[model samples]
Target: MEPLRTVTVRALSGRVGTVGSGDGGVRMTQLNGKPVQLKEEADEPGWEVDPDDDWGIAVVETVGRQLKLRREAVGMRAADFGLAVGYGEDLVYKIESGKRIPRPEYLDKADKVLDAGGLLSAMKEDVKKVRYPKNVREIAKLEAQAVELGVYVGLSLHGLLQTPEHARALFEARQPPYSEEEVERLVAARMARKAVFDKSPVPALSFVQEEAALRRRIGGTMVRRRQLEHLLGVARLRNVTFQVMPTESGAHPGVDGKIELLKFADGTAVGRSDGAFNGRPTTEPKELRILELRYSTIRAEALTPGESLAFIEQLLGET
Candidate 1:
């Protein structure tokens, strides 16, 4: 096995000191009379709290108070606690003061360090939802409960089917451009929506993509090849039905734009069409009926599931 790497912090005019090789996690090493943590991985996320998410804000604040209370109860100062938990003192204060969202891994470390018997770690579920954008969480919640989902995208691969590299490339190409952190966050959220495919009893997922979308090569050769390969795999899933709307079969109902319809086990459904009803998702039976009709027509015009998989495989070979 490779040796564990160590980090030295503020060693100005001072010799290094101390040791403890943790379970391949952040290890404590003393230097310059200050406690330091060794590098482990890219910095954990969930640093910033969404300003518009009131419920998420409240959850973060509650978790922060718990962390603060537990640390204080054990008579550990902020700096001491930070050293023990493998983070900076200021970061600890920020999380405790409700100025930042704490990452799930951090909670696990805190739970062990504070002897909370999994209480701190258990808070991960609550904090997990807060880490994502408000709109994303709302969408994810709907997808999680949906029993049937139908999506049509004329321009790009739907979020649930996109590879991380493809999604990152798309995000990076936006006009205003997203920061590295925001790109990572959005990608993570998109990936989480895929959990719908893994839900117990599994949701029946149906996706329709334009032929041009498959041939566009969005994320360069290797990335696009991987995406096409992934699409083939997903297409083959028993519960998933994928189709491609060939360009040659023009003048289709999908020409208006994207369509998304999600039906629940309770018989309730929500649908949205870019060209209809101002593009707002609606639960009204009439609106949903219209969207469903258009979707059914589009699906009828698109290539069959078997043909779609063959089409994607050909694209992969071309790459």
Candidate 2:
């Protein structure tokens, strides 16, 4: 593949112009025998594209190529294009080189500035499909395939059981605060993982949540009320079980933190913990045994499935 040349493009009164590097003149190129202005400079930083992510890479590269072509077709400098699109020059260069993922609004502005006739903005849908961080997708995949899923949550509701409003509240409360678009995307992905509940041969699902998690009031009173009601409904599923460890249970094995186990019909399993294993998912049998033991003990100590439902109902009444 030929190396990408760095071209200084400037958007001038809605038209693109190229400034020559060596001489105080402009250089032009031809597209289908029609003369067009383009200039060459040093290459920008190269992005280390992930080889495992073919779809994501393809979408980004396509958008980048289209943006570059449109800018060049009209003779716009990257800096000038950035100015028109409400971004910095370096960001414009990164976005055009496929090193940065442009936000949807960025594409909208670029479409208008470059006079793309909606061509550039149309890429937003493709980009949105791959916008989620890769790790979340992997976890969602595991949840979708498991024959049995066990979870012990200490702080917040498990993603699989979160109501849309509750999940949105959690995402909105992140430290840096996700953009409105990002909050919507994350909530949608989280909700999609709930497909496990609707799968044929319905997976056996067990949840052990600390009492604190139930009473934390994640999304304030109204959201929390709906979330509790949602939990009561989920607990009624024949294949699902819910257990709540009372706050007075006092320093149990689960005090170490959250734990998760997923078992498949083929006897393959994976486990994760926020305690000893440092929170990374593991498939090793030894790690799986330890996680299973801890989870089993926590579930045994928690309130029985029927009692847990009553507890949630009581909490709902208090709301």
Candidate 3:
């Protein structure tokens, strides 16, 4: 039998850490200045906060722990693993140290080398879900889980339904132009988010669009036509309800900002405001009551379901 390779472990900050024996396998040496047993195959990637356990660690810390454990168990040194994965040893160190985000490719390579089943893939999704700007990622998460989404867009077509051409133009128009690759990635991400529409239990989506979103022609005539046609097709989904907040409405709470109210299976609501990171994932009764009141007011101030549909048709005719 192969002899087990042992490595020194040290407590850093408040978490366990292990240093390689310049090879594969790790053994704990100390934790929090005291000796503690570190199992080679035990699941200790992330911490759950009970009063008895530590809390206040970000999810990223857990991911770093998992990567470290997996890397050591496979008997590969950080430099060797980096070689196999096409990255520098320093990058591997940074990732294992929880100082940087691991790319999907790095995670895949680690998974293969460590025989990690699907843990790496799952971690990829978790990391992506966490790293993107909080507001956009949160909206993406709620969108995926939502059985019904009420979207009110003031400046442009709802992102999920945008074509690649339109999406690129929109993204590039940011203060700085997005690189070609960034634009492609952004478009792909948007398209993937739209898959919720195709789920077996399709989400009920009601889009209350502003007249300006249609009239502005964001990507010019061809892109605008495609966007309009896409909107009409999405509107046809039996589960989907489309509405337009007309200019003629004079004024409404919707005019205050963009609103995305998601209704989950448990009757909870999550929402994003117009600005970045301006949202709450609230399930508390008091917060829910407040969101309910505000949403109801906004809905009332906007057109009724029937009237909104007619407004969409009116804009469609103008096109």
Report, for all candidates in order, the number of backbone clashes.
0, 8, 1
**Residue 133, candidate 3: alpha-carbon lDDT:** 41
As for candidate 3, its clashing pairs are 24-75
Sort the candidates on lDDT, descending order: 1, 2, 3
lDDT of each: 0.80, 0.77, 0.63
Question: Which tens-of-lDDT digit does each residue in 88-196 have in candidate 2?
Answer: 5566776778766667788998888777777788888666545545667677767878999999999988888899899999988999987766676567667656878
RMSD of each: 8.5, 12.9, 13.9
- The ten-residue window of minimal lDDT in model 2 covers 39-48
Candidate maximizing TM-score: 1
- Candidate 3 at residue 218, lDDT? 74
For model 2, the local distance difference test gives 0.77
lDDT of each residue in 118-201, candidate 3, tens digit only: 677677776655434433666688788888787777888888768767877798898777665455556656765776887777
TM per prediction: 0.75, 0.62, 0.56
Q: How do the residues 246-272 of candidate 1 rate in per-residue lDDT, one tens digit apiece? A: 999979898989999999999999998
Candidate 1 overall Cα lDDT vs. reference?
A: 0.80
